[model samples]
Each structure stands twice: as structure tokens, then as C-alpha cells.
Target: MKKSISITLCAALLALSGCSQNTSSDALSSDISSAASESQSTASQEESSGSSLQNGNGGFKVEGTKLLDANGKEFIMRGINHAHTWYLDEDTTAIKAIAETGSNVVRVVCSDGEQWTKDTENMLETVINLCIDNEMIAVVEVHDATGKDDKTALDKATDYWIEMKNALIGKEQYVILNIANEWTGGWNGELWRDGYTESIPKLREAGIKNTILVDAAGWGQYAKSIGDYGKEVFDSDPDKNTMFAVHMYGTAGKNSSVIEKNLKYAIDNGLCVIVGEFGYTHTDGDVDEAFIMKYCQENGIGYIGWSWKGNSGGVEYLDIANSWDGSVLSADWGENLVNGENGIKQTSVKCSVFTKE
Candidate 1:
């Protein structure tokens, strides 16, 4: 069994911003305990409101803060992000290799002809089928809007999803439509909320019903944006089938306290969230990857490490597997995330839908 941390020690480890040095440990503990209780109460209320798989349109659904697969079984995404748009040729074999690590999901990056070559409808179908063949869920995301605060880019991405309806309309049971990766560049919570609130309906109106995943603003590190307006954005979805995601790099993953506080706030708000992307370390600073994996595991949250391979721009170290076929894994990030305690290999369970007769 995975080791657990006490609430008190967990609170104590929080940064000074969270727990003042002048504050007594007892007071800190009391505050954290209250928050935890409130979170549980809120989750219970959400579940009681009929937010279960029965309400879903035959696809993934969010119940309270848990994700239920098409089979109505709880599913936690333990997987890696594969940059398919950049390394299209490697995906065929790379996805199979990723499945070998016991992962149950793969966040496949694609472009909408805005920033990179548009992944044609045929290519999209091929990639999603590859993941399904490997017994993993496909999280299809458009990379064109990364770090763009402009609403036009986000709209274009939405348009791309609509154009690919032929490939996504019937794959709701096996695919997640991540609207656009890091759609906003700044930490403007209001803008972030408005952009998604506007774009989500467009996708729904276009006949897309897959569970939508929206990344946090500020290049996906601004968890504060999600904590502040995640509910409003989620409510914008007419289907109420949207979930939030946060990319944890140095800015958001520098310490245990920051990570806990960000993720806890989202969970406490009764929002379905996942660590959509995270690296062991980044140019901004070092990341507490160990805590991220441990906390997600114990809390029944989901995480997808960034990435499978083919990282560039001086961030090549972020690649988890060195060889495309996964014949050799990186010594630090790859080894630990895939094979270490609380890692994918130790915790992932294939979605029950694949096993059902």
C-alpha cells in the first residue's frame, strides 16, 4: 500500500504563504481539517444531486470529483502526453509501448492547421484507434492555441473540433476532447473563464458530446484561475460534462504546499480535475514530482506525465522515454514516473469498458 501523510504534517509542510510561521501548528491543523471536512461535504452534496454515470449520454461523466468511465466504473488517468503532431510517425509504435507500462490513457497532441500541420480527420481517427487498440483512452487536444490569450485562436480550435466531427462524434466512450491546450497566456481568471464559457457551447452545438477537458490559463500553470472560475466554466457546458485540467510545471509544482493547495482548492469546489501535464523539472524551477504522484494516488485523482518522447527547445530532458519504441527509458523522469512507487505501472488499471463483454 502507498504511504500516507498526516493532515497536520501536510499542513505544516505548506509554504509560508499558506501557513504563516507565526501561526501555531494546532491552528494550522485546525484550518486544514475544516477545509477537508468542507470538501467532503460538498462532494457528498454533488453526488446527491444525481451527478452519476446514469445522467451521461453513454460516455465518460464526472460524479462529484471522480471520473466514471463509460462502464460506470471509476477511472483515474495514469498516463503520458504524446506529442503526436510533432512526431506523427512514431505514434504507431510509441502508443503500444506506452500501453506496456500499464497506462490507461494517453493525451495525444494534435494541431488544427493554426500552429502546426492540421491533423486531418483521417489522422485523428487513426490516432484515436491506435489508443483504443492499445486499451488506453485517447485525450485529443489541439495545440494551436497554446499560450494564446486571444479568443480567435481558441475559436479556431473549436472550429477544428467541429470539422473533425466525423472522427469524434461516435468515440465518446473512448475519447476526451480537450478543447485547446493552455488556451490563455496570462493569469487573467475572468478571461480564462470567458474564453471557455464561450467555446464550450460552440462544441456542444456542433454536436460534440465527448467529456471536454479545459486546461488552466497562464500556460496551464495558473491553478488559481481554475479555483476561481472553474465552476462557471463547467456550468457553461450545456451537457455539464466538462472537467478541468492543470499543467504543473515549476510555477505550480515547485513545492508540496503549492501543489496540494491548488489541487485541493479545485477538489474542494467539487470540480473534476486532473494534472493534465507535468514535468520532473522545468526552466522556471524544480518540480516536486514525487509529491504530485503520491497526492494524486492517495486522493483518487488522475495524472498524465508530460511526455512520451521528442521534447525540444532545450527541454528535451522532459521526455520520459528516450527511444520511440520505449525500448529505453530516461534514467530520472522516465524511470521514476513509470516504474517507481505510486507511478503509472504500479497504479494504473485499464478502463473497465474494455474488459466488459
Candidate 2:
């Protein structure tokens, strides 16, 4: 399900007044600063899309905190997450510039097949160029409003993801498929249990050998139940490529207890875990991002920020005046404010805690 209206969060997300930072932002100025070339030789596009998940050599291995290249090199993915805006925007020089900033990967958002129009495919093809030009990896995802643990929905979404994945098969050699965005099935456990198991095989059979990311049920709000199932499915497969994902909404969970427990169990069981999403929300009094980031770094877990709209998701909500925005990161942390707006652009090509620290 999709809606065009503004989404004010429940009490947890609604406590925005405390958002340390406040300001209108053309936060993506970096993206706008420099533009990418729309001109790519047809042959180059064909070659990249032809490349497979399996790298030069077969039998993929783990990379530094993320999936390894097929050749067994520990993959270090520096990247961004594009939750929306594809079909509508045909030209994205800023996107390529994002890759240039040193992000080795990007997570592209997708709705179930219902939203895949001819335009979407074209935009996706261009994204392939952005990834290829920057030598970055790609993560494709499904975004449903009220995602249930329904097979029909999962299949449709998976199909949509594959179409994008398949198109880039040869184009970008390093693309991963994320099962769904957060996975909220009204907190129904059994339904999730049955649905995920079935969906995995379907994706695998499609030649999607890239390690897939599965989310904790309840939009990653309930790690206990979601973690339990993650281990079960993982243990059953006997493979090391998959990872269990959780979305971190500061105070959204009962406590850090949920995250702490999930991390411990995933480690003990030898299954990989990642904080697929989290932002500046004051989910807990502390904002909790450092915990998740710190834990991931210490434990070899991978993390992709909730977003990179001028890095505004965190900065804007924190009320940090983006030095560039001058005013501040805009209040529309999760929504779009302007389409035609353009100015100062992304100058940096790479980002990460390891680098910053």
C-alpha cells in the first residue's frame, strides 16, 4: 500500500520538536553540485549488465563487514540508500556523483510490481550506469506500506526486484537483493515465519546468488521474534551468504534489549546481522545510533544509514545546520520538499565511520 500524504510519526517519531537541528535544506546540494554524464557507450552498459554476482572466481566469501566479491575478497561497501525517486527522475547526475563520493554501494527502493512502469525500468537502467561508473555495489529493495507476510505480495515484489536485478546482472557485478523494507505484517509471527521461508527459495532459484538481506518482522520493531526466525531459516540453509536485517527506530523498540539479544544470538549461531535502517529519531533518549553503529563496527556488522538526502535524515532532525544548507537541514527528513530546486552539490564521493574516525 502507498500513500501520497505526509506521514507524521506516532508519539515516538512525532517528538520532532526535540530534533536538535532545524532548517530548510537543499541538503542534497552535494548531489546537485556536480553532474554525471548521460552519455555512456551502449557497449559499456551491456558489459556491466552482463556481469554476474559471481565474480571472476566462483564461491563468494565475506568481505569487510559486508558480502565478499565472488573471488573471495572481503568486500568493503561504502554506500548510500535511495529510498525513493527513480521513475520520475530520468536524469540523475547527482546519483553518479554520490557513487563517486566513495560510496561503494547504494540501496534502491522499490514497491511491489504494481509500481513498475516502463519509466521505472528506464530510471533503474540509468542507476546501473551510476553504480558502474563509480564502481559501486547495488542493493535493491521492496517498499510496501503495510507489507503483510503474504506470498502473493512477496512474489510480486520479488519479481519487481528481480527485473531490476536482472537488468543490471551484466551491468553491475555487485548487486544484492534486500527482501523487503522493514517487513511489517501487523506483528503476525506465524505468517512471517511461513512467508519468508518460501520467498527465499524463490529468489535463490532465480540465480540471485548474491547474499540476501531479510528484515525483522514488525518493520524491525520486534527483534526477538524476528531474530528467532532469522536464525531458524539461516540454520536450515547451511549457507553463509544470507544476513538478518533490523531497522533501528531509536525508541521504537521496547529497549536496546531487543537489539542486544539479537546481536548476541546471531553471533553465537554464526549468522550475519545488519542494521539495515535507522535515523536521527529520538527513539530512545540517546538517539541510539552510536550503539548500533558501534556494535556493527566492533562485531563486523554492516550498516546503511536510513538515508542520504543531504545526509539530512540525521542532520536535519538533529537540527544541525548543514554548513552548506546555511539555513539547516529541512524538516522534511523523510519526504520531498522540492523537485526543481538545485544548487551546491555533493563534492565528497565516499563516507563511513571507519573513515571519519
Candidate 3:
């Protein structure tokens, strides 16, 4: 769902440095810049692999800019985001409903207690198993860091993932650990770069090896940051299994040229990326959802819509389904996103791991 901040402020400040729910200080930026620059050479030395890295371990791995499933087949995500933390009761049925749409993935929202109720390890395990049972890959993410520049909060979210090792480990074949959703509200690339560059190693050291997914700065709308320093973050992982994601709202998706340029910047740089979250219309402005889907489909890039249900705070329209059971699909947003041209139904292909040999 679109952030629940003041849209008026966002709209007024849209042209100037873009709109972010929070702001960062120059002192913080300077400190991060110094720390992040120290690892520049080391990250640059690690080249992107051109061959599949699956290794028969039954886990998703990155080869260049492509995401290969456990079977070593390229898997392009086409799915929707589910607010599982906000609507925990819906998990058992919601996941099954989402799978019925022919989606190949589902980005499940979890909380680290920074802003919402913390989802315990048991709850996370349940959500993950539900996706696997339905044959859909689960992209689990912590939502507390959305649109915030506080490194402590970001680190706390990271800690949450490390603590969930019991639930995440050994499920690499079925899970993607999205570090945080829309972290670092400011447009400072160095902050986004340094923060993740520092955090990636912590996760790897702690033994959470699922392909880590990192969102762009400026509320996940700033793709230029990924293009500028994404390689550094990607290389920070000893496993070289990190993937970048950009959330498309009005700021980044207002037009076709902006959308294509943002996406191509990372792709051209040999980085694996995906549209982690997007909506047709947003508080910032109207989004070119059609072009987003069309471009991703044409290029073998992956995309997931904003949400399945449970949107509020003046952004309820973003909900794709009117009911948790998915019995009634919202007229335009839900229907078009799922069944319309270049939508998930037409483009999503189940990962080979789910098919019988």
C-alpha cells in the first residue's frame, strides 16, 4: 500500500529533491559516506558471475542479472504483495487465493516491532510454508523500515532477520529474504549504499543465505542509487547472491522514459533487479502501471503489484481484491493487474521446482 504520510507535503515537495516521509542530517550522510567508501575497491573486485550458481543445493541463485530457481531454471516473479502482518488471519486463505491467480510469487509483509506488532518466528514459518504448499515462492520482508532514514531501525530489522534463522534457513529453495521495505527515506545514495553494504555481511555471517533483496532509497523510488552503488552492495555479499528491488510509485513511475531509464540503469550495469512493489495510482501522482508491466515482461524482468487486500489511510484503492478470499476482484486495479494485457496471469510461469518431473 502507498505510505500513509501527508500526501499534500509530498505533492508540494515532489519537484524539489523528491518527497520522503523522513529526512536525514548532513552529519549522518558524511559518516556513512566515509564508512561506505572504504569498501569500494573490494566490492569492485568481485565480478558478476555469468554462469548459474545453484550448485545442486536446491536454492535460488543469481547468475549475472537472472534469478534461477532451485532447478537452475530462470524464474521471473509475477505476483502481488500481501499484508500478512496487518492481516495475519488471512494467511491460510489469502495465500491460496493469491496462487489461484496464477502468480508465481507473493511478497509477504512482516513486522519487526519497529512500527508494528512483531511477527514471531512461528508466524513467519507458517506464512512461508503456506506459500510453498501453494507452489508460490515467498518474498518475505519487514515493513517497519519503510520511508525512514534511521540506521538503528534499519539495523533492528536486520537483526530481526538474523533472529529468524530457524524459520528462514534451509528454505532457500522457497524463500527470498527481502532485507527491508522502502528503507532510507532520503535520496542520499551513500547512506543507502553504506547501510546495506554494512548489513549484507552481517546476514551472511549469521548464516542467512537466502537470496537477499534490498530496496532502493527514497522510499524505494530512487533507482539511480541502485545504478550508482548497487554493485557495491551486491558484491558485499560473499555469496554474491544479493538482488536489488525498486518500488514504483508516482515519483519513479510517472512516465515511460523515467521508468525505462531507471530500470535500464541497473540492468545495463549487470545487476539483478525486480519491481518489488507498484500501484496504478498513488498519492504522489498517477503511475504508468501498463508500461511497468509491459517493460518487465518484454525484458524478462520480474514485477509484483502493490497488494492483495487490507489497504487503508486514504490509499484503500490500492487493494487489488475486495475480499480476503479473493472472491471479488476490484474492478480496474485488481482485474486489470491480474487478467489484463501483460498481467500476471498471462506472464507468470510457475517455478519448475513445483512441477513433477
Best by lDDT: 3
**Candidate 2 backbone clash number:** 32
User: lDDT tens string, model 3, 138-235?
Assistant: 99999888877889878999999999888989998899999888887778899999899999999989988898899988888888898899999998
Q: What is the Cα root-mean-square deviation between model 3 and the actual structure? A: 11.3
Q: Choose 2 or 3, whichever is better by lDDT.
A: 3
Candidate order, lDDT descending: 3, 1, 2
The superposed Cα distance between candidate 1 and the true structure at residue 257, in angstroms, equals 0.3
Local distance difference test, candidate 1: 0.82
Q: Looking at model 2, which ten-residue stretch has the lowest summed lDDT?
A: 335-344
Stretches of candidate 1 exceeding 4 Å from the true structure: 1-55
TM-score of each: 0.85, 0.65, 0.87
Candidate that beats the other on TM-score, 1 or 3, i.e. the better one: 3
> CA lDDT of 147 in candidate 1?
75
The alpha-carbon lDDT assigned to residue 122 of candidate 2 equals 65
Q: lDDT (0-100) at residue 342 of candidate 3?
A: 97
